[model samples]
Target: MTYQRLAYDDAATPEQMHADCRVVTALLRPAPSIRFEDYPREVVKPTLEISEAAARLATALHLHLD
Candidate 1:
């Protein structure tokens, strides 16, 4: 959960983006009691991936949870 910026290049292809999104979501979605800060620095890319997945999920579900 540490606030490290995602390091992947902005020009990453759609496939890479999708894979990253899945990895991040998987990393974040477990252990409901775990805070974001409990995650390690190496998890930043996955964190960004999770963020993107969350945004997409919200949009797809027509949710305004953000």
Candidate 2:
């Protein structure tokens, strides 16, 4: 999975801050013999609409980055 965060103005609203946010997920069928990186992957946006909620949640929580 990958996240692309866009630069925003300091005064940007929550909606605007997440307007261009995108979450990319690379999916592959499970297989024992195949290497994870070698498998064919389908790239997609799994939660394109969840960014605003995520941002709000993050802002509310006190994350211990320990």
- Candidate closest to the true structure, highest lDDT: 1
Model 1, which residues run further than 4 Å from truth? 1-10, 30-66
Which lDDT tens digits does candidate 1 get at residues 1-66? 688777885688999999999999888855565766866556444333347778889989998753
lDDT of 1: 0.75
Looking at model 1, the pairs that clash are 1-36, 1-37, 1-39
Across 1-66, the per-residue lDDT of candidate 2 in tens digits comes to 998776974576877656645322234445576666876797886754556667677667954222
